[model samples]
Target: MRVVVQRSKKASVTVDGEITGQINSGLVILVGVTHDDKEADAAYLSDKIANLRIFEDAAGKMNLSLLDVGGQILSVSQFTLYGDCRNGRRPSFIDAARPEQAIELYETFNRFLREKGIQVETGRFGAMMDVALTNDGPVTLIIDSKDKKA
Candidate 1:
């Protein structure tokens, strides 16, 4: 499992000209899954992201977690995170998990976030989506469960 977490002032996802998910003053999470990912990876990321202290506190220090700021989450499925371009100009998605497995883990990840008492919105899995966001601090981080294990 991999996730690109971005702090955003606002964000939304549109599918076929219809807005699917939106959030104000929160994090926009681009989630990706690989063939080797398991439920444990999803669990780990959910907990880490919820508790990550990236939000600014009163002292202008990045000491506030999403929970501390009562922020929402806009989770979008993005298999492209696994795209490999080492070989050629066209990226290969061979590392990405199959749609069925990806969707299952993706839903599980959202459920884990919801269980953490966070307001979580999501984009339609496997759909063509257009995501828009106003980056708060332009603070972005990429996390991979494989890296954690190593």
Candidate 2:
């Protein structure tokens, strides 16, 4: 499991010219899954992201977590995060999970976030989506479940 988390003041996703999901102030999460990803991976990332302290506090320090700031989440499924371009000009998505598996984990991930008491919105899985966001602080971070030292 991999996720690109971006702090945003506002964000929305449009599918076929219709807005599917939107958020006022929160993180826009681009989520990806690989062939071997398991429920544990989804669980790990959901907890990590929910508690990540990227939002600034009153002292202007990045000490506030999404939970602390009562922020929303706009989660988008993005298999492209697994794109591999090491071989040629074109990228290969061989590591990305199949749509069936991807969607299952994607929904599980959102469910995990919701269980954490965060307001989570999402783009349509397997749909071509146009996402728009005002990236707050332009603060972005990439997290991968496989990177855990343990």
Candidate 3:
């Protein structure tokens, strides 16, 4: 499992010109799953996302977690995160998990975050989406459960 976690002042997802999910002062999460991703991967990533501290504190140090800041999460399913571009000009999506399996794990990931007491919103599964955000601090991070394990 892989994720692009962007800290945002505001964010939203629109499908077919309709807003699906939006958040204020939170995160825009682009999630990806691979064939090897298991339920544990979701659990791992969600836990890290909830507890990882990037927000600033009183001294302007990045010491606040999302929970401390009362931030929400706008989770979006993004299989393209798995797109492999090293081989050729055209990216190969062979590393992406099948939709059915990916969706289940994706839901589990969201649920896990909620279970950690964070508010979460989500994009429609398997949809072409337009996501917009004001990236706070322009702070973005890539997290891989596979690498985190090591």
lDDT (Cα, tens digit) per residue for candidate 1, span 1-150 = 999999999999999999999999999999999999999999999999999999998999999999999999999999999999999799999999999999999999999999999999989999999999999888999999888854
Question: What's the candidate order when arranged by decreasing TM-score?
Answer: 2, 1, 3
Q: List the residue pairs that clash in candidate 1.
A: none
Candidate 3 regions off by >4 Å?
none
Better of 1 and 2 by TM-score: 2
TM-score of each: 0.98, 0.99, 0.98
Task: List where candidate 2 sits over 4 angstroms from the true fold.
Answer: none
Candidate 3 residue-wise lDDT, 1-150, digit = tens: 999999999999999999999999989999999999999999999989988899999999999999999999999999999999998699999999999999999999999999988889988999999999999998999999999745
Residue 99, candidate 3: alpha-carbon lDDT: 98
Per residue, candidate 2 scores C-alpha lDDT tens digits across 20-136 of 999999999999999999999999999999999999999999999999999999999999999999998999999999999999999999999999999999899999999999999
Report how far off residue 40 is in candidate 2 (Å): 0.3
Q: Give the TM-score of candidate 3.
A: 0.98
